[model samples]
Target: MTMKIVKTLFLKAPPEHVWKFLTEADQLALWFHRGAADLKEGGDWTLVTNTYGKEGEKMCWGKVLEMKKPERLVHTFTHNHLKGVETTCTWTLEAVKGGTILTLVHDGWEKYEDDPFGMAANHDSGWDEHFGRLRRVAS
Candidate 1:
């Protein structure tokens, strides 16, 4: 089974504006997490999430595999809970009449086999919540 998590949402902003929220450290922290990144191909990035109380902060690190300003980005993602397991995340943005359509694809879970910890589901819900915040920030 090829496991993947996909989500799409329309934001009330142009692709350029939305791109900043995805790439800039301060802007990302407002909607997603506290972290910084170079945002270029092969650049390293990190995000520290404080949303899970008692579990403290969880750090996710990745390297940018591809980047096209205001259009698309592909990166390798991994976190502590996954014990160095790596996956790919792609984000594509399209301009529309009212806003930009953002599509996110997080794939490569088949590498984890049975996924006894359900990390994919946790990330699915996490993206949903973060996207909601992203919408508000972009509005």
Candidate 2:
């Protein structure tokens, strides 16, 4: 298997608008989990949610690896709940006729000694949930 969860979405918003939802703490919470802080290259980040149990409990944590404004972003990521495994999340945004084409490539499941495929399946569903929210908010 390729060991990656790849998804592409068409957002009815400009690249700049989509960028904020991905990087800004407040903007992120509008769609995905609330970010601990704005994401920037070379900086650490954590996504937390107050819904499941305790408030501000971390869902994911990672370091921003690379970013090229309104275009590309790459980060080292890991779900805190699935400890001992780290992966990478890469996002690419391309301007289109009416909006932006956003692509996500989440990989690095090769590190999972126990159940890589199962984890990939769970994450695939998780991303779909977030993406659905993003589409609605960004519209």
Candidate 3:
């Protein structure tokens, strides 16, 4: 498996605005998923999907490792119900044309792969949907 996966998106807003929706848990719940998130170094972050189960039964639990606003965010991510695996997720923002170009790189997926590109393929599709959702939110 590759060590990293990159997903890029061209949003219709500036880095500052996009970063708000990306970093702030309230704004994030509007587009990404629902959960209470504390925006701080070493803060808690949990992502809940309504399609899955009750409020307390959702997945995507993690902690914020770095919280540099509007430019970079690094976090450790793991599914709430899944054990023995965790990944580092980083979001990088850059100024572009009339908006922001966001690149999300998720590294550390190599350990669970029994076949090459297995994790990459799974993440590729997931990111594609997520980027599309983010674009719609930005627009």
Candidate 4:
């Protein structure tokens, strides 16, 4: 089975507003980890954290695959926690009646010989926590 973590969140803000939180460094720092540089397609995608493990250290680093403002983003993701294995994260934004629907699909784990549920569950919880903060500020 392919191990993956998918989450759908409804934010009380338009796609334009929600997109900023997903791409811009300043806006990302307010909800998620600190962006190491401007997020652009084909550029380095680095997110640093002060609380995860080390202080002011990169939590994840990879290359940005695709970035369509206010619509979608795809990136290669890897961190120390993944034991050097890389994955892909795709964020899709949909404009709704009064807000945006942000869906995150973190996949590419079809051969992780360990307990998939445990692994996916951990990341799933982490995403929920991040989304909680995103909701507060985006609204």
Which clashing pairs does model 3 show?
none
Q: How many angstroms is residue 101 displaced in model 4 relative to the true structure, after the best TM-score fit?
A: 0.8
lDDT of model number 2: 0.91
Candidate 2: residue 51 Cα off by (Å): 1.7
User: For model 4, what is the alpha-carbon lDDT of residue 40?
Assistant: 90
Alpha carbon lDDT of residue 55, candidate 1?
Answer: 32
Q: Among these predicted structures, which one has the highest lDDT? A: 2
lDDT of each: 0.84, 0.91, 0.77, 0.86
| lDDT tens digits by residue: candidate 1, 26-127 | 788888887655466778988876566723354888999999998999999888777778999999999999899999999877676557338788888899
Give the per-residue lDDT of model 3 (tens digit) for 3-53: 788888888798989988777767787777776664677887787776744
Best by TM-score: 2
Report the C-alpha lDDT of model 4 over 72-138, residue by residue, as the tens digit: 9999888887777778999999999999999999997654446557767887888899989998999
lDDT of 1 at 40: 67
* Runs with alpha carbons beyond 4 Å of true place in candidate 2: none
CA shift at 125, candidate 4, in angstroms?
0.9
Error of 3 at 91 (Å): 0.5
Off by over 4 Å in 1: 49-58, 114-117
Point out where model 4 deviates above 4 Å: none
Pairs that clash in candidate 1 = none
lDDT of 3 at 110: 72
